[model samples]
Target: MAAVRVEVSVLPDSVLLQILALLPPWDRLRAAGVCRRWRRLALDRAVWKHVDLSQRRLSSGSLWQLLRRVLPAGLSTLRARGCLLSASRQRLLSPALLSALGKRCPQLRCLALSETDLRRIPYASVPASLTALELRRCELPISWFHPMAPSGTLRRLLLHHVPAFADWHLMAASCQHPLRVLSLRGTHRVTEAGLLQAAPQLKGLRHLELWGCGAGDATMGAIGSHMKQLRVLEVVDCPVSSAGLGPLKSLQGLERLCLELGEKVAPKAVIALAQALPRLRELQIVGACSGMDEIRLSLSHCSCSHSPQAPD
Candidate 1:
């Protein structure tokens, strides 16, 4: 009764559109079916600027319908995963669909695909407007990691659990951009040499993460020498110690540092880092709990993760 009494037409188009933009792709479709006024406002191009359909699967015909009905031409970022994109396959999205998306969404700036089959993606299929890309657990060709990368536009690249990813792959990738962030998690094959080779290319990188991947002092040294503007550094479940990490002192802007030691790091190395990164806001250290009490007590402000887990 209340919904009927309140005429939605009286609500400014801007307010209704804002409400529509906040809904997920599935819920947004449901809201559009509510009434004619909402359908008009929901169809506004700006509402479809960023569409993430990572949780649902759709048939090729269904995809075409969704694209025409809800996806606007002005889409800037599109994230799709677990989708039945091909008409023949129940769980695979065809490269043809990917190509169509790139063509239709000219303004697309960011693309993230996880748990998707990217077996046949072609060269130049990604829109040139893209600046950020994240791929995880996908069946992608090695060429997509290098030759197909949007060399001129990409500024941030993240690869997580990509079986094809390796140290040499990063070595071959286009490194023209001073990338802002390079996160390679679950890419165990990448090592010190691979990161070192790519470090020089990503001099402007601010956030660096090597989670659950092997890393050593050389990797730390490479990062320190190249990424001088690095702000956040997290190296979890990697074989890294305080020895080579001393180079981090060169980073004047470093704010947060989290290290999960895989080897016994020297105490002096920890002290060096504390003395070097004076502007640090949070410093978390795990696995080297033996002689860290004095160091932890000295830098009371910095949080250290100790055995049995220390208080926050």
Candidate 2:
């Protein structure tokens, strides 16, 4: 038999770090358990920066062990986005992993833990350097946002499907930082007055999403007045009328706009929307808004092909 020779290029530490950083959470963890050279390469500070512990797959003990090995005290950033938990296994995170994460990944930025049980997942005194936080699904206790400590550098923030803020005043008051991107999706409890009061303070805010938000036109108007530099705005399932977005014409940076016009919006209303936000690069409309004949027909056929409504 001929000698079966395989030639492979050995990647340097820098290249290896880039490769490891791109791998999924579990794969990275496994790679860290390889030989000493690979282990050292895997444990680099940059390797575990964007940790995705979503789906709550790894046991608390295993997570702790992995963190101890790969994520040293020197780690600066940790992004655990899309973290999930079944109804039966809500409070599954152990204290050790939480402690290590809070202490080690102090400069944590872009933390996206959507649809996870965060009630018992010890909320660390968030580091000042932390910028973006997407708490999309976790219905944390009111105490979570009670700390009034201002994070001057914090930028993007997204809150979706969380419990109503019992003390909305305190919650809004606590957000002294200037935000760039903000999303308040499915926050039924947040009244228009509360949001209007807080919107102006976030002077740097450019992108805003109020999906299923119960705020009225007055609040929407208030937001528009304050957010002069606003770019992209999504008012999904909200009742903001043509008048609400009328002021958006002044927004020179406006790019994308999404609105659910509901069952009875006339044809003229839809045309008005396109005219109002003329610079819109992308527009998504749901329900019975008229004047979008081509869009409606296309959507109707698309919806019928699958399950009618867009798949979850």
Candidate 3:
């Protein structure tokens, strides 16, 4: 019998691309070296749509180099962290590299970065295509992010443990974009005035979650008054009062309500919420499951002190 000659080199580019997609990012790059055909297939935009560099112990130098080579123009989602940059340099360098990243990946939508300073990132460089952004455990200035894109594009934003995020920042986002969902976890500095100022302006907001915030009347009142289109509201371990819950009656569109209070709170607020939100499909009281239908009220067991928790 004659020896069979099987050659991936002769395979169709589409077929080779399908095979390359199955390999990990590092391995795919290795396969690219096998032949020019493989190199072409590996660099295809579809092959690098979602890139995650959290696993690699990459330095800013190597990260910059990688962005220049591997980052495709049509990338959609990216999660990068693990690069340890000093505060002073991070502010200067991150925005430039991020700008470069956005320029190459114009179609980029979701960007999540941790342990990085995002303050210095130029507003002009932010990708207009972004729909969701999550910044966790970053040291940033107050209202560092603005509406770099046009109206009604960015819908979801999550700020976790970011000290600099205040009323003006939220207001800036509210005024610029029609945000649908917003999450504030471990952000403690935002006082009553900031919350009140920013809350009512989110006309398109549907979902809002506040965790580990002690902001009492100011926070709740804002949600009650301005979050008219809100459907899901989660207030966990906050010092909300019956006085604040007074505004819940105005939220006719509200469907799901998750409320948690410490042992210190009287049952007055809970009773008021139960009465006000008759349309609630899911309800959680003090970390307990009290609703009849399919309800998701996951509560964090925050003790006496929980806000502004450092990221692990």
Best by TM-score: 1
Sorted by TM-score (best first), the order is 1, 2, 3
Per-residue lDDT of 167-220 in model 1, one digit per residue for the tens? 766765536444788888888788777787788877878898887665778888
Check candidate 1 and list the clashing pairs: none
Candidate that beats the other on lDDT, 1 or 3, i.e. the better one: 1
Q: Each candidate's TM vs. the true structure?
A: 0.85, 0.76, 0.74
Runs in model 3 lying further than 4 Å from the true structure: 1-24, 31-41, 82-93, 146-152, 262-279, 287-312
lDDT of 2 by residue, 137-168 (tens): 66565555544644455677777777644336
Best candidate, lDDT-wise?
A: 1
Clash totals for all models, in order? 0, 1, 0
Q: Of the candidates numbered 1 and 2, which has the greater TM-score value?
A: 1
List clashing residue pairs in candidate 3: none
* Per-residue C-alpha lDDT of model 3 across residues 1-312, encoded as one tens digit per residue: 999998866788788778877667788888778777778788887788887765554456666877789888888887766433664533323666777877888989998777666665555566778999888776665535565545646789898887777766776777777789998888887666767777766767899888765467667766777788888887876745557677777777777766665444445445455556656655555443223222222222211112232223
* Clashes in predicted model 1: 0
Q: What is the TM-score (0 to 1) of candidate 2?
A: 0.76
lDDT, each prediction:
0.73, 0.61, 0.68
